[model samples]
Target chain A: EPEVTQTPSHQVTQMGQEVILRCVPISNHLYFYWYRQILGQKVEFLVSFYNNEISEKSEIFDDQFSVERPDGSNFTLKIRSTKLEDSAMYFCASSDDRGWETQYFGPGTRLLVL
Target chain B: SQQGEEDPQALSIQEGENATMNCSYKTSINNLQWYRQNSGRGLVHLILIRSNEREKHSGRLRVTLDTSKKSSSLLITASRAADTASYFCATDARNFNKFYFGSGTKLNVKP
Candidate 1:
């Protein structure tokens, strides 16, 4: 079974620095999403990307956050300036074109900002 | 805000025991999905139940959705030590493209 893949399984960055989390979603998937889990908290949605544009975003996806599909398979989330609160497990997910399709997720990148 | 909240944040059982987790949401939903996450790992899709359906099963996993009550339950029968993971319930509301995940229930199936 094809699965989503992410790079840099774990990252440690200084506060105020920029960070880019990369993901390669399932090849044939059209909808891509980013979510974060803060330690013991629930997984929170960050943004959804489709057709090279953002389809939806949450309040946590503020000015500091941006997503790009720089290539056919690569979907990346960039944080302009990281904050301590931004430290979390960032996950990338993708689904086929079918509406409400099951989303396949990557192993996730653990971002640690200090 | 619309959110999926799971009950009994933690559970522990021996191998071959059944585990049940429940989730409740505040509003109408288009579909409900269950996911499992190992410690510090990514989420794995378990099952999805549409609003029009009442119950669905896959292997040892059984899910039931009651849209009228805005609640759902997931039952894992004859669970094994490998089944020890945090289970989450996610809701997809109508016209909403994003999914809201619950806090999750941490299950510890001892061997």
Candidate 2:
């Protein structure tokens, strides 16, 4: 079974520094999404990407956040400047059909902004 | 505001017992999905129940959706220690591609 995979399983960065979390979603899947989970909080949607553009985003996805599909397989989330509150587990997911369909998720990247 | 919320934030049971988790949502949804996450890991898709469906099952996992009541339940029968993990319910609102997740229920199935 093909699965979504992410790089840099864990990262530690200083506040005010830029960070890029990378993911390679299921090859044939069309829709991609990014979500974050604070240590003890629910998963929060960040953004969804399709056709090289953002389809939907949450209020939490502010100007500091940007997503790019720089290549056919690589989808990345870039945080212009990290904040302490940004420490969380970031997961990348993809679905073969509509974004609402069942999505396969990657193991996640743990980002710690100190 | 959160779309889904789960009850019994934590549960502990012995192997071979059954575990049940309930989920409630605040809005009309197109579908509800259940996922599992190990400590510090990612979300794993478990099952999805559409608004029109009342119940669905896969292996030891059973899910029931009551659209009218805006509630759902997940049952894991004949559980094992490996079943210990946090379970979450995600709701997809009508015409929306995004999913709102619940706080999740942490299940610990002891050997």
Candidate 3:
């Protein structure tokens, strides 16, 4: 089965530095999403991308966060300036259909902003 | 405000037991999905129950969705030590694809 894959399984960066998390979604999938899980907290939605644009985003997805499908398969999330509270496990998911179909998720990238 | 919240933050059971977790949401949803995550790991898709479907099963996992009540339940039967993980319920709300996940239930199946 084809699965979503992410780059840099773990990332460590300074609080003021920028970070980019990359993901290669399932080839045929049209919808992509990014979620983050803080330690001992629920998974929180960050943003969703489809057709080369963000479809929906959460309040947590502030101006510091941006997502782009730079290429056919590569979807990246860029944080302009990281914060200590941004430390979390970031997961990328994709699905061929929306709102009703199953979404396959990547193993996730653990981001630590110190 | 979170859209979904899970009950019983933690559970412990002997091997070969059953684990049940409940999820309650605030908004109408198109579907409810169950996912599992091991310690410090990513979410893994387990089962999905559509709004129109009351119940669905895959292998040892069973999920039921009650639209009227805006709640769902996931049952893992004959669970083993491998089933020891955090289980979460994610909702695909009406008219959108983003997932709202609950806090999850941590199950420790003692072998």
TM-score of each: 0.98, 0.98, 0.96
In model 2, pairs of residues that clash are: none
**Candidate with maximal lDDT:** 2
True contacts kept of each: 0.79, 0.85, 0.85
Give the number of the best model, judged by DockQ. Answer: 2
Judge the docking of candidate 2 as incorrect, acceptable, medium or high: high
TM-score of chain B of each: 0.97, 0.97, 0.96
For residues A1-114, could you state the per-residue lDDT of candidate 1 as single tens digits? Answer: 899999899999999999999999999989999999999998999998888899999999999999999989899999999999999999999999974668788999999999
**Would candidate 3 be rated incorrect, acceptable, medium or high by CAPRI criteria?**
medium
What are the per-residue Cα lDDT tens digits for candidate 3 across A7-111? 999999999899999999999889999999998888988988887889899899999999999878799999999999999999999998553488889999999
Error of 1 at A28 (Å): 0.8
DockQ, structure candidate 3: 0.77
Q: Which scores greater on DockQ, model 1 or model 2?
A: 2
The digit string of per-residue lDDT tens for model 3 on B7-109 reads 8899999999999999999988888889999999888999888899999999998888888999999999999999999999988777466888898999999
Complex DockQ, candidate 2: 0.82
lDDT of 3 at A37: 92
- TM-score of chain A by itself in each prediction: 0.98, 0.98, 0.97
